[model samples]
Target: MRLIYCCGVVLLLTLFSRVSHGGNILVFPVEGSHWVNMDVLLRALHSKGHNITIVRNSKSWYVEENSTYYHSITVPVERSLGKEVITHLISTVIDFERGALPVTSFFNMAVGMMGTFTEAHRIVSEFASAMFDDQEFLRKLKDSNFDLVLTDPCWGHGIILAKYLNLPLVYNVRWLIAGEAHFSLAPSPLSYIPITGTGNTDKMTFLQRVKNVVMYLIGQTQHHVVVTQTYQKLCEKYLGPNSDFNELSLSADLWLMRVDFVFEYPRPTMPNFVYIGGFQCTPAKALPQQLEDFVQSSGEHGVILMSMGSFVSALPADMTNEIAAAFAKLPQKVIWRHKGDRPANLGNNTLLVDWMPQNDLLGHPKMKLFVAHGGTNGVQEALYHGIPVVGIPLFIDQYDNLMRLKERGGAQILQINSVDKDNFLKAVEEVLNDPLYRMNMQRLSRLHRDQPMKPLDNALFWMEFVMRHKGAAHLRTESYRMPWYSYYSVDVGLFLFGVFLLVLTTVFILMRCLYRTMCKPKVKQE
Candidate 1:
């Protein structure tokens, strides 16, 4: 017994001696669902003995003043987003559905981003200026001497902060980002990948490709005009005279994109681009007693969950009435995630609440199908649980996600405006009754789970990989350094075309001269 105890102690000592503490990592998460992204990563890093400080601009589930895992700094930011911007953006989707927004759904998103850019810029600037101007706060924040900076490029301010701290930067792309913010760190061609808001699939026709190209061109033409001015001014003010944000975005050490071929189609990615999709996910959790009772009370009929995400809480009265009517027709129990007033004449089979354990609810054996507004998180969760989806996508990437899910045969999309009881009933029936949907969902779930390492583990591996290699500059592709026209080979194509046209014109001119000389009136001249 004495010898065994000594051996155990020696083993523990050896393990402790082998553990190497990683560098300090600073995380800046955007407000809303994006905050939920860190549930796994931050805690895992903490358990591994790394210093993690989260910069909190608003209230969220992930952060507290003090925790065993991490520390959060409270920064008051007054600007409120989501409600008005999304309402307006979705109102345009009605246009696209009706063929009024033209062919380029990618360009239309740029227009929406244009309308909201000023507000986004203002909020980011205020947050940045607040951090910079506070003498004591700034001193304390800088005193930590962080080694790496991790940011969600929901806005373009993280790169600036990385510059301020003179630390290695790693950016997190929180969504598919097919069009909106992908151009800087990665390249997504139109051959396979669709635009973010456009309901296009990988198999696009020639005309669809043409529309996609036009959208890309329109996005390129207006991209710099809409976003860069504010970024440049803020860079000058906060980061010195010549510190441009554009240059910083391209030069970031790594880009962790929340995308994968399991959910998204295959696309070209650079060495610095790491796919960490579904990292925010977990293996489900135990349901609270109330939720457990609710599912149990449903008996063998099972239940369905309705969630429109955190940002979209309100539904038009007419839309609400339609969804309620559809629930009334179904035998399965209904659980809706809503905070506002409930629709009148809601069926006894239906229950409404502001919140429920969504992941747990999805993982329930009684969960036959999920009715969601098609947020990436919600859609991905439904996919993870291998539950067929009845998608009522509201705005932005939701539409694109819904389209992809439909193409994958695991979902049926119900249009918000055209969602009568019949259509909603049809979607629910199709998802629940069709065995094919379940089979497809199961396939995708397997693919998602079959990776060499867990998504969170893969994320941590790359995060530390960049830190270990001292910024991983060699992973950044030469394409980032190429000028826009040169990167697209537009200048080269145009130069070659111009030479061909010059030669053709010269030959035509000479032929005309020679023909005239041959047909000349020589006898008259003599």
Candidate 2:
């Protein structure tokens, strides 16, 4: 798995240049903000001539019922699970930010994730029941003879199904949370790799390190406990009575994570772990006619784009208006992704759309600043386009991403709770007026772009590599065999300590005997 720079390796990869895989690839995309990056990989794999069938909720299955490059298998859902997911997610953050939730110990981030798992468990149960209960659907699915299954590890349904279907499973995760962090697929050392959601960078202060370890331990524990409890039922009922979901998830063939050492601290990663950061980005395309005109009409001031990503498309109505008020005051024209009815006081400079081409807007020459909720896809997109940001981070990993950018001088994070007109306006103006933000972003953009290969090319290559090798099991880490105590050398340290104690005790006993013999010399002679 070691990457070779030789001509042979190049020739081997070149062999796949026109490789149109005839195999069927099935994908199960998890709910929420992951769609941006997931779509990129699925589309690329489909374009490479693999039959890609995305089993998505019927509501969000935008793909036609029939197609050549891509198709959809509908898993009927009752309602938009979006509202429940984000409502619970935002509520957790609100509790933490207000100090209503205790953080002095393990309950810190663990409690929040318990709620998240419940939401995931609920949604996945609905999806799984729909899939498994329908005998026709189940028979058709098992007959598909999929070569591989692409999935989000947020839910265990994919892993369980892949195992049932006798196909290799590859986990493509958008979030780098504790569950993936602790997986046997790679090494994510806690000392450097900040606990996801905790806003620490690679270099942390003493207090931050202490907090990092606590968060790390708790997060991993919570993920294991909750997921095991929730998914074990599904696995037993559907897959097998004694089958464990966690073990199945860990046994996946490979992992394609939306992470890179450039954005994150340099850490050890197993060969099977692929970094496809900026996979959401592509060559910029023309904006919609209306958006193009708005930017054109703005002339010199440029345009500012604000989107909270798909998850948080609509904040509370009042909060949305308060935000719009800030945009109204800006010299630049505004494009806001709105999910609800337009605000009454909408400014002439602002335009509300259900969706706009996010990447295209960032790549636009006149995109002045991006105000975002700091989702990985949007953050990476902004970094790739070299645009300064006014980050309003909403949740866990978003906080860390925004903090990373803020520390690097490419952005300023306005507090999510304390966001009012003045504070929001100040952060926006600072990023807009400051040359450093632009300069820092340009440097980061270069670093992000200057990799040995394009992110998409790398993603395609590694996934193809998995196929070429029939599985990337060769790249799986040996850490899987190492026990927790042995992996950290704690047992060895204790063994050495025991030996030292034994030697010291023996020497002390001998010395006491010698002292007693010498002191009783006269009596001993008698």
**Cα-based TM-score, every candidate:** 0.85, 0.85
lDDT (tens digit, per residue) of candidate 1 on 389-492: 98887666787887777898888887665688888888798788879998998888888888888877888888888778768888887776677799889999
- Pairs in clash, predicted candidate 2: none
Q: Give the Cα-based TM-score of candidate 2 against the true structure.
A: 0.85
Q: Provide the overall lDDT of each model, using Cα atoms, as 2-decimal numbers.
A: 0.75, 0.76
Per-residue alpha-carbon lDDT of model 2 for 13-91, expressed as tens digits? 7656545445678888865566656777887887776778888777653334565667788877775356565666776
| Lowest lDDT 10-residue stretch of candidate 1 | 175-184
Q: Tell me the spans in candidate 2 whose CA falls farther than 4 Å from its real position.
A: 1-20, 57-68, 75-113, 129-139, 176-185, 236-243, 495-523
TM-score of 1: 0.85
